[model samples]
Target: MNAFEINGGKPLRGEIIPQGAKNEALQVISAVLLTEEQVIISNVPDIKDVNKLIELLGDLGVRVEHLKKDTYSFQAKDIDLDFFMSEQFKAKGGSLRGSIMIVGPLLARFGKASIPKPGGDKIGRRRLDTHFLGFEKLGAKFNYNSKTNFFNVDASHLKGAYILLDEASVTGTANVIMAAVLAKGITTIYNAACEPYIQQLCKMLNRMGAKISGIGSNLLNIEGVEKLGGTEHRLLPDMIEIGSFIGLAAMTGSEITIKDVHYNELGIIPDIFKRMGIRLKLRGDDIYIPSQPHYEIDTFIDGSILTVADAPWPGFTPDLLSIVLVVATQAKGNVMIHQKMFESRLFFVDKLIDMGAQIILCDPHRATVMGLDKQVQLRGIEMTSPDIRAGVSLLIAALSASGRSIIHNIEQIERGYQDIDIRLRALGADIKRINTMPKQH
Candidate 1:
């Protein structure tokens, strides 16, 4: 296993650029399968999950060309549908959660697709009912084999229909949109996820000849096109990474600048950090976080304790709650973190507690953190990374803590953050990657 050894208490400096959106890349790259013509995508992050999806595409006979660094051209002119039945496909496709996305485009264009139970961070029970229900609404036949944990979908003729999602799931919306774009008639998706990534997907699909309206709202209308043409797309900067950097800067008391952040699309992230009293500035498109000796959390106007909860787009994102929780550890006041979407996300607070931060894990979904206000510095200890967000949260805590710390299962962090050690190194972070040897029996 690979681990990160971090020497803490040193503040990071210099400018850092956020990586291309991993979530957006997954959606847009999967959309390439909708067209037989070449589709070029830029700003694709060189991370494990995205690379695994690209490899799966190549394995399915999609002509993939690495045009340049972070740019690729894909043409699914001769997709080998037969490969879906191969053991190779089973092994590769089942390994990535994003691999489930390829199913929509494959079903839309070629009339059928199958994927084994997709794998990803063990945060919670992420149900696939939304995707399948949306597909079935678009006239697709769905089947799940409990014996093999495989899902198969097929639609000889997809006819668009109105769909009110049980929840505004981003990936589910993307999948349904991809399927409905090629169906006959109009598809109205109500209570849809309208995050910037979803809007980007809809905009890219429109450029590829899809008729989609309501770009940035919960309601979307898509009119089916016979076939889509190729289009080039550039992914937005990863807002999650940007948020992480903001937390990193605040936790370490580092005056750092994050470049090319696409400010307007950040939603409530900046405001949320500001609520924590982390002083930041918006210069052009960059976020400049000044070194803070002490930051305080803001209570509600009624003097109640501050509560930060995750909601859909236009609301605080659940992904950044971990960072917020970590940043709150050193702030001047107390705040409650309500992770409504995922129950197990707040469990990582135990690691933070071990590091000498004052945190109360109230339950599976709630944690109340009392900031030490820099009066007490967190002393590091060995820990295992539980998930992607939690891993980076621990990394940020380690960077700001007093002693040396070792974090195992860094692969979770690498799955999302690109060249994290190298990037933090550019900003003068005392962190390095090390391979741990297997235990000898």
Candidate 2:
């Protein structure tokens, strides 16, 4: 296993550019399978999850080319349908949750799709019932194989239908949209996820000759087309990374500029940080955070303690609540973090408490953090990362601690962030990557 040894208490200075959105890239790359022509995608993050999905594409005989750094072109003209039933796919497809999205495009173009049980962070119960239910709504036959643990969907002919999703699940909506784009009639999706990633997917599909309207709203209208053509798409900068940078600046007392953020699309992220009393300024397309000796948390107007929580789109994302909780540890007041989406995301606060942060885990979904206000610096300690968001949160906590900290299970971190150690080192962070071999009994 590999760990990061971070010597903290130094302010990071310089510019850091956010990588491409991981969620968006997954959906966009999956859409390439809908058409046989070459589809070029730019600004794709070279993270483990994405690389694993790309490898899965290669296993399916999709011709993938690396045109340049963070750019790739995919041609699915010669895809090997047999690969989906191979033992190799059973292993690879179950490795990442994003692998489940392949079912949409594969079913659209090949009339059949199957995926083994998907695996990702053990945050909570991430059910695929939303996905399979959507497929069943579109006249597809859905079956599950208990022995192989695979969910299979087959459709001799797909006809569009009205789908009212149980929840606005992002991946579910994307998968259903991909399937609907090549159906035989109009498909109307109500209560769909309207995240920027989903909006981008709808726009890209439109560019590829699929007629999709209501790009930024919860109700989407997709007109089925006979076929789709190749089109080039560019991914948006990762909003989660940008939010992490904001927290890092406040926690480490750093002056950092996050470059090329699509600020207009980042609905309430900036304002949310501002509520935490972090000083942020917009410079063109960049977010500049100056060094601060102390940041204070704001209370509600009626004199109640401040609370930050996550919701669906146009609201705070559940992904950044961990970052927000970590940043609140050093603020000059108290704040309540409500992680509405995932039940177990706040469990990592116990590790932060071991490092001298004042946190009260109210339950599986709520935490109350009493900020230190720079009265005392957090002392470093050895810990293990739990999930992607929590891993980055721990890294931020380690960066601001008074002494050296060791974090294990860094693979969780690498699955999302691209070259994180190198990027932080460029900003003067004292982080080192070390691999340790297990001891024999």
Stretch of 10 with least lDDT, candidate 2: 432-441
- Over 9-127, each residue of candidate 2 has an lDDT whose tens digit, in order, gives 89999999999999999999999999999999999999999999998998898999999999999999998988878999999998899999899998888899889999999899898
- Cα lDDT tens digits for candidate 1, 87-203: 898888888999989888988899999999999998998989999999999999989999887898889899989999999999999999999999999999999999999999999
- Determine the backbone clash count of candidate 1: 0
TM-score of every model versus the real structure: 0.99, 0.98
Model 2, residue 58: displacement in angstroms? 0.8
